[model samples]
Target: MKTIVQTPDAPAPIGPYSQAVKSGSTLYVSGQIAIDPASGELINDSIENETRQVMKNLGAILSEAGMNFSHVVKCSIFVTDMNNFAKVNAVYGEFFTSNPPARETVEVSALPKFVNVEISCIAIS
Candidate 1:
């Protein structure tokens, strides 16, 4: 059966969608931006900070599903500017020290809330 997952630690969905969905051992996490759930504020002061917040938001959703970075199999990262790739990668790397998940970073014209970065992942429990 499929199950929806939500958590207060992560920013609530801006639209009508759950933070994640679980089907069997796999958890599908939705794209996360830099919105801080505690204060509901956007953390876009810097690209690194924004990426950190996005990763934090993703982490919260994974935790809610009883999973972590190690369990992640793949991830999708979207950025408005390819120039910010290095900065974003640095912070994102902090989450996975070894055996990192397969991922692709794409440059786009825009993202929700016009943030510089957004990330989503798939994990197994």
Candidate 2:
């Protein structure tokens, strides 16, 4: 069976989608931006800070589903500029220590809120 996951620790969905959905052993997280859950506002002005916030948001969702970064099997990262890839990767690496998930990073024409980075993940439980 499939289930939807929601948590106040992370930003609420901006549209019709749920924060995440679970099917059997895997959980599919929706794309997360840098919006803070408490204030419902963007968290940082710089790409590094914004990327950190995005990671934190994803962490919160993963925790809510009883999964951690180690359980993540894959990730998809979208960035406004490829130039910021290294900085984003640094912050992202802080979460996944070993056996990190397979990932793809791409430069997008634009992102919601024009944020520098956004990330979505898939985790197994």
Question: Which candidate's lDDT is highest?
Answer: 1
Give residue 78's lDDT in candidate 2 (0 to 100).
Answer: 99
Q: By TM-score, who's the top model here? A: 1
Off by over 4 Å in 2: none
TM-score of 1: 0.98
Please, what are the lDDT tens digits per residue for candidate 2 over residues 1-125? 98999999999998999999999999999999999999899976888889999999999999999998999999999998899999999999999989999999999999888788899999999
Q: What's each prediction's TM-score?
A: 0.98, 0.97
Please give the TM-score that candidate 2 achieves against the real structure: 0.97
lDDT of 1 by residue, 76-121 (tens): 9999999999999999999999999999999999999999999999
Q: Which residue runs of candidate 1 sit more than 4 Å off their true CA positions?
A: none
